[model samples]
Target: MERIAVSALRKTFTLKPGQTVTVDGVTSDRIAVLDGVDLTIDSGEFITVVGPSGSGKSVLLDVIAGLTEATSGVARIDGIEVSKPQTRTAYVFQQYALFPWRTALQNVEYALEVRGVATAERRDKARHFLHLFGLKGFEDRFPSQLSGGMQQRVAIARALSTDPQVLLMDEPFAALDAQTRDILQSELLRIWEQIKTTVVFVTHSIDEAIYLADRVVVMTARPASIKEIVAIDLPRPRDLDIRNSAAFNAYRGRVWESLRDEVGKAQRDWALASSYAN
Candidate 1:
């Protein structure tokens, strides 16, 4: 059942000879963002990761996506080690990353085109996903012509159009207003329910993590490792209404408890580094 596996993962970024960073008043020549991290994700699972800023949540996603290689250990999908971008995975970054020149439909079709899907079929597939994401009538619009939320929706549609077995998202809604984020969250759940694709989403919002994740992966401070894996037993096909429920609050409380110390440490480290910089 494990579709993704990461074992004893360690990544160290060695600075140039003269480069140094001070953390907690200690100067360091190397930065360890992920150290001894081990995790397993099942197929068709929706997993969300939450940690303080700079806790390497994004790095973990990058490693799995094969955008960054580990200094040690390995990450694998379906038992194959991840070394480079693979067809089975699609990544949606914080930025829309849509080609400004490409219309919504064209943007969606681009992935299919790269995979060698024929013109007519890719167009049909792109149109269908855009429609499903509530951008049916706006497929002709360019990314510049659309609202921030609309552009992100197009990005999501494009990612899904490829029918990837694994979807990796890095704070995909971090820049959006609350109302837009709420809308997209529900829409994403709708799409996920229909298609049941495996998703690994990284976010800092506890509320968003609880709402979207079937299980939440909490990571430690820099040199990240799994701190906790909390499972949500809530019924599926969820909506925003669940946000107000006692069970929801309970989950939020639990996750926050695990996260508070990490956040404090990160803030302290930042303050220390700032003082050193000054």
Candidate 2:
């Protein structure tokens, strides 16, 4: 079953008067981030998106999350148009975004609270997820007291507390140290296997993209569109050591090969735009 569908999706940002940007030596008052993107995501499938900097990968996620609107197309969840955030969808952003005053348990409970879950039930649910994320002892620790990795765990726990059918994560681990990132990656896969929510995760790291995806969606540079959708053939219960396996490297190489040109083009465009700004 298709849980999310995007068709002819184009997101444009029109600058206010006197504002402009240079792209490939051309100046424009409007920027097209997503251009005619078409995709179908199956229920409970994990999809990872990768692209060059400024390729609108995050924008695509925002559109699907209904945090942003498309300029000329449609994004749908369960065949219903996505014009606003859906109750069945949850988003985890790159930033931990945990309320500073809230304890880890409180942060996780916030989602359920918003939905009006009874206090006793929400508390139990939050504790369960916190334990699942290995934050049992730290449940009362405020975001200020937790380590970066632990903070992120709370963020992920909060997103999942709602039992959302679709989870949209935009580089949720990007800010962590590499070792922490790797740990969280494995932890995420472990939890995901048990819950099986449909996921759309955006990442700049090719390795992370491949490690977490059922399919990797590579987007072109600015004015982004699908470059290729590469299916991951690796077996499940994947360990971090799989990163060294020849099969894993083969998948990485394929994704990089498709993405290399786009990376170069995005860089060149950035250079050109920078020169124009000078």
Candidate 3:
């Protein structure tokens, strides 16, 4: 079933006078970051979005999450137009975004607390998710006491504790070391298999995008639109070793090929804008 739908979506930002920004090969008083973008994400689907910097990949996620409104078109969740944050949706960003004073368990319970869940029930749910994310013994530790990976794990645990119908992640693991990132990737896949929640993850890494997605959505440069949607046919229960497989490499190449020109274009646009600023 189509759990989320975006149709002819357009988002424009009006720049202050003398604040010049270039988008879609044009420099103007207003810029359209997302232009006529359309996409449909099914229930329980894992979709990864990839594109060059400033290509509105994050904007698309924001629109779908109801953090930003479209200047035109609409984004719908379960057939209802999304104008504000949906109760059944959860968002996890690159930052841990956990309270420094809160313990791991308390951080996870925050979401449930906001929803008015009973104190005892919320505590149990938080503990279950934290343990599932491998933070079992660290439950009492504050964010400052944990490593970067542990912090992110707690963030993910908190997001999942709500048992969200849709999970919107914006490079949630981007800050971790390569090794830690790999470990969390495997762990995430394992957890996803059991809960099967709909996920829309945005990342800059082609490998990460391909590895985590059922289909990878590649967007064009500024005035971003869907350039391509690459289906990942690789088997699930995927391990880190699969990255070394020939098929995985092939998929990587295809995604990079589609993204290469857009990246170049984005860079060129940035350079041009800088020159003009000077």
Candidate 4:
């Protein structure tokens, strides 16, 4: 079954003096940054969206998460049109977005608190998730007390605590060091394998996309549209070794080759905008 269905999705923002549609029109914008985009995802599928910065990768994730309202078009989760934020869908942002003052367990419990889950029950559930992330001993640690990767683990635990059916992540690993990011990527895959939730992940890293997703959705520069959707049929339980494989490099090359033009366009746009700002 389709977990997400987007149709004629369009989003526009008018700068104070200029009215512009950042995304014009397309069939699916599930990973399209511009207006009028359309796309669909089946249940339990892991899909990664990759493109140069400003290609609207993050915007597309936001649209699916209902964080950004589309000027026109439809984004539906489980066949219901998404008009507002729904708990069935969860978003894990790049910043980790955790409370520095809260302990890791408390951070995960926050969502349950808002949902009014009883104290005892929420604590039990939060503990389960924290332990699943190898954070059992650090449940009492605050965000400031943990490393970058640990903090992101807590963030993931908190997002999963709600038992969301669809997970929308925006560059959740971009802030970590290379080794840390690699570790978390494996952990994320383990969790996904167990939970089998539908995931829409956004990133600019080619290797990351190749490492994690079952399919990679490549997008164009601003007014972003789906340039191509390439399948990564690599065998799972994938690890660092997969990165050195011929199959991995072959797929990586295809994704990069398809994105080369869009990356150039984004760079040109940045240059022009920088000149105008000065």
Model 4, 1-278: lDDT tens digits are: 89999888776654544423222343232333485667889999999999889877787778788888887888999889887888888889899999988999999999899999999999999999999999989999889999989999999999999999999999999999999999999999999999999999998799999899999999888777788999999997787889999999999999999999999998987886677567
Stretches off by above 4 angstroms in model 3 are 22-27
When 2 and 3 are scored with TM-score, the better candidate is 2
Error at 258, model 1, angstroms: 0.2
lDDT of 3 at 179: 94
Best by lDDT: 2
- Candidate 1: stretches off by over 4 Å: 23-26
Backbone clashes (count) for model 4:
14
Tens digits of per-residue lDDT for model 1, 64-166: 9999999999999999999999998999988989999999999999999999999999999999999998887998999999999999999999999888999
**Each candidate: RMSD to true structure?**
1.2, 1.1, 1.5, 4.0
Which candidate do you rate higher for lDDT, 1 or 2?
2
Clashing pairs in 3: none
- How much lDDT does each candidate structure score? 0.93, 0.94, 0.93, 0.87
lDDT of 4: 0.87
